[model samples]
Target: MTTRIDRASAGLPPAAPVRAVHLGLGGFHRSHQAWYTAASPEWGIAAYTFRNTELPRALEQQEGAYTLLVPGAPEATEAIGSISRAHPGADRASWSRDLACPDVAVLTLTVTEAAYAAPERDADSATGRLLAGLRERFRTSGAPIALVPCDNVPDNGAVLRSVLRAATRDDLRFSGWLEEQVSIASTVVDRITPAPTPRDVREVLDTTGLRDEAPVVAEPFSEWLISGDFPAGRPPWELRGARFVDDVGVYQQRKLWFLNGAHTLLAYAGLARGHRTVREAVGDDVLVEMVQAWWQTASRHIPIDAAELAEYRRRLIERFAAPGLRHELAQIAEGGSQKIPARWLPVLRAERAAGRLPEPLVRGLAAWVAHLRVGEVRDPRAAELVGSARAADPVRRTLSALGPDAGADDELVSAVGAELATLAKAGN
Candidate 1:
């Protein structure tokens, strides 16, 4: 079952000193972003996982090469030659040490919503980890690296800057130091990427006959919209259908509203309905209708026109329905508290402000809060979070416990509470 890489599968690896450095080197980043880089052999990317040694061990053993499969009924792996090295994030000594090298120009991050999560700016939860990471990158060495945050937070570059500013310890010199160097770029990345399961590994092995210890599998569709500057340069991803626009906000709004917002809906409602994967949930007629209804309302407000929105919607439906993509309910549920504010709150706030409260969106929010009551899922890293949960009103309880934003008036709170009560009594 151990097959040497098909030399024809991926072209010759590009010449030395890796051009890009990726953080949070999980399966999704491999299948999605790395796949983009692999399409062009020139941009050899050396990536690292966040504090996980196994990824480094796997990559180095393979000589910085692995299989990336486009997930489907019959999975197929394409040999990738982009990665030249891998390391663990906690090994910041090496992590920081690598960034200083002049060859590394672009840095991409896929550290999940929790990394950039600040549910409410006013709350004590906000910190400038991304900012600090960049400032430190500059402080360690004045090497100009493009800080591309692949995480999906609103105005992500701005958020990155704000956090770095916040973490400067109220020190003007440090703030000045930050302002002088570093180009914190923002990007909106899309792909129906799911964590690989044993079944997935089996398929990759069976079809490709490649003994890939760490293969990344995702659906065919993918996108990356970069809004910030790439001072030190970046991958020519646009050649392979990526759009490098002046403002990715319109695109982001279209996506964040339907794609991500719909995901939140399915995660909670789909879980309640006994559907496990996002694909499974969207497949059910009842749930699909709910998704459609929710999207119709939200899409109307998207910055894009009707024709473009319609096409995006169509593409979204097809992407969600990708049977090969096993986007887990639990993975979607990972940082509910962290993600709720950025993806869900804006829609809720806009609707309420317009005097039209979106019931489905409210249901999605309630379902997430209801998940807190179950306690079957455990995020050990988030041990500090679960302990502090409290509630006066169910709405107040959920928001208050979330560590940010008491959000709107009593009317909205009651609406959320009523929905939560319905969900609780419905016993899903």
Candidate 2:
């Protein structure tokens, strides 16, 4: 029998005080935020999942210690102990209590973009639960706290503030208190952490002689760019390579359009071409050309220097082609309704407004339409998207489903439709 991972068995130090609370605990959070926090042992995270209990339960069994496997020339693994407490979403009492504690200075979120769309009245949603916690904090200590959103949505800080304002509109007292006490911080986080497979667990036992049920496998690359106020104070995340900038908008766009947009394109176009993993798709000459063409159009809109952008793209191609990192196209393809608008449409709109129809972006959109017709779509708006795919005017209806502005673009609609026909003829 392998030795189970616990604080003592892993030779970890005493658990730090829970100075931060994180929602949507998952592989990305573990490999990114929690890993960064581990660099500062004084700041521990009390992590809660949105709905899943198995991850929390598994972490709880191991005293919130897990292995982070970074695969490279010589594979490296570390015991991440930044998460001091792991609680299921059902444990609302602990969540409220933790938030109310004056010592908990920051509340970080990794809930996907879809969670933000949950109805304001739905108290069970991620934002709803946050509102409840804020109310508890207001009623108790009324301490200033930062709300850091680490998702891929554009202007995520302002977006989250908007959602919270709408949720608390009727309650003037709570709303006022919220405005006075809360600071929403936007962040651009990047790390390629694939869902842990059983092989990861087995490898942990084989290499480290410790059985970690919740091991996370990630690429060697990781980045966290933060912009906002932490009135009550926060960890020295800067020591761990986190940059605190005045304007994260440019960086956000660079990430959203360059990194995430490419991923979305590869996910759809790659899958349509019968590729499974990012590595496999990026290796194909056809898919690589598609990606390069899309990058060319997207680069025109980004304000960054040309050399830097080229270097970024070069590094991205290397990262995408990282061997043994099974970043699945199907996994990246989830929630296209939320992702496409954020990732591709901005470039499409800008290119169209410039009197140039971007063929690569149009092809990417067409690939999405084709995928919706036959791929395994796991989106919050799946029914509507799949329905739109089957419509007589599929491209028009699909664009409409994405957003009103996209649907109204006559030139874009024609281009995407034409590309879809070509894709169908080519069996893509």
Give the Cα lDDT of each candidate.
0.71, 0.90
Best model number under lDDT: 2
lDDT of 2 by residue, 138-211 (tens): 99999999999999989999999999988888999999988988999989999998887777777777778999
Residue pairs with backbone atoms closer than 3 Å in model 2 (clashes): none
TM-scores, all models, native as reference: 0.87, 0.97
| Regions of candidate 2 where Cα sits further than 4 Å from its true position | 73-75
Give the candidate number with the greatest TM-score: 2
Q: Candidate 1 — which pairs collide?
A: 391-397
The local lDDT score (0 to 100) that residue 4 gets in candidate 2 is: 91
